[model samples]
Target: MTVPERPVRVLVCDDQALVRAGYATIFAGYGFDVVGEAPDGTAAVRLARELQPDVVVMDVHMPGIDGIEATRLLAGPDAATPAKVLVVTTFHTDENVYEALRAGASGFLLKDATPDQLVEGVRTVAAGESLISPSVTRQLIGRYATRLRPSAPAPADDGPLAVLTPREREALTLIARGLSNAEIAAELVVSRETVKTYVSRILTKLDLRDRVQAVVLAYRLGLVSADG
Candidate 1:
């Protein structure tokens, strides 16, 4: 018999009690475990370190450390055992979204997102996938690609890109352009399974955690242009 998966454990953090309650209710209804709740980033971090939830639904504007700093502490490069963070906020501007991503947020969602979207966002992050709203992908990453470049000069010779085959490069480009696996399959005239394999190989070769990191790397490495 096939084994069933465990319910995703989630921690909800928001200054508004109503918002936290609403998200907790939705997650519970979806069979997720609402492990804890926090009204501020400091508490959020403390609870996250304590509970070690699979996913953290974080808000950006909370007082006392705010979400960005909290995310960095919980999920950033220096984190001892990073938790996946899905940043939910009212703002959709490039700066806010980009900063959250830089702080190691696994995903970004708007507070106005539908219940279905919120549930899916939590599941996505918990499953080690990343979700950025399509609008944020287009508006923030596509429009502001140059801003994503690093201050240091890029290597002159073949670097990480050299590891990927041509087809993997093509797949990476489409992923950077915000195409889903199914969409990429259709675009490349291949089966979805084939696309999945390519994506898996790409991620392994590039040592990327998920599509979010891949998208950011593509931009930083100039694999995908800002215009298209």
Candidate 2:
């Protein structure tokens, strides 16, 4: 007989008690392990460090420490061992979204997303994928393009991007433009599996956690203007 698969452990962080309860119910209904819930970012960081859940569903505007700072503590470059963070945000919180992205968040799920979408977002980040929808991503990033780092690391011969093969680099550009694997396959006239392979290789070579960082790098390289 096969052993049962382990449930994905999730930590929900939001200021509102109702929101926290709602998320917990949705995740529990999906058979996910709702390990912990925090009413504020301060508690979020503390609980996450102790429980080490597989995914953290974070809110942007919590009391005490904001979600962006909490994310930085949990997943930032300085984090000794980063936890995957899925930031739930609205379009009005674009600045927080950008900051959270910079702080090493794995992906974004809109606040108004359906219960199914909520579970899917957590699952995506838990599986080491990012929630980068083409239209929404371009809109969010383009609005704050100036906040992006001005340096173009992709062009530098000795930079991290230089380590990728030509095809891998091409895939990275498409990914940056927010193309799904299927869309990328059509654009490049390759199989979807082939695009997936390229994406995996590109991330490995660049030492990136997911497609969000890849998109950021591609923008820095000027591969796509991509305003939403």
Candidate 3:
């Protein structure tokens, strides 16, 4: 419901021309500034650098470079000023979901999602929130993440999150379970602002980039399992 204060700058990338035009139009309709469009990851990366859009709508599979690689170039830890990337993937390439997340995607959007969902996906990531509003998509990220993660195990109780307070830890567990801040607020009988504070503190303590990273860390540490 809340749009960005200014026009959210966006870059749309897909190998298909029609898909590119359609998404650009949709984003433009919603008052987003479609700064540039790219047909492949190489162009996406280049245009993103040249344009400095607030968010990049990236397709997973492309002819050159690909979305995962582009995401890394744009949003990876080494990026001096990382751009927020919303990766668009499909069920068939579910494994790429984890790869994209690992490559520093700010969020995930399934290819099958409708136009409205697609728009919201960009908005969500641009607002610095993960696009896990699609609960099923969030669950799938956890499921695929479990499969793609390495065999090495981590301590369930005392890894990077050992520094968190008890309530913050509980909130993070709920986050890994795909609960939004609003949902977690209701669950904890606290206000949404309070939940936001808790999430901020948790991210600060763990030195994480965003909720997507937090979710991945949770799955890796076995704090929340794929089955759940």
Task: Estimate every model's Cα lDDT from 0 to 1.
Answer: 0.87, 0.83, 0.85
Error of 2 at 194 (Å): 2.9
| Residue range 96-158, candidate 2, lDDT tens digits | 767878899998877888888888888889988888432355657654553564754345344
Among residues 3 or more apart in sequence or in different chains, the pairs in candidate 3 whose N, CA or C atoms overlap within 3 Å are none
Candidate 1 local lDDT, 38-138, one digit each (tens): 99999999999999999999999999999999999998889998889999999888888878888889999998899999999998888777899755755
Off by over 4 Å in 2: 132-135, 142-146, 151-158
Give RMSD (Å) of candidate 3 vs. truth.
Answer: 3.0
Q: Give the lowest summed-lDDT range of ten residues in model 3.
A: 131-140
Superposed on all Cα atoms, the candidates' RMSDs to the truth, in angstroms, are: 2.1, 2.4, 3.0
Candidate numbers sorted by lDDT from highest down: 1, 3, 2
Q: lDDT of model 1 at residue 172?
A: 89
Q: What TM-score goes with each of the models?
A: 0.91, 0.89, 0.89
Stretches of model 3 off by over 4 angstroms after superposition:
1-4, 133-139, 144-154
| Cand. 3 Cα-lDDT | 0.85
Taking the tens digit of each residue's C-alpha lDDT, what string does model 3 give over 17-75?
Answer: 99889888888898989999999999999999999998999988899898899999999
Residue 221 error, candidate 1, Å: 1.5
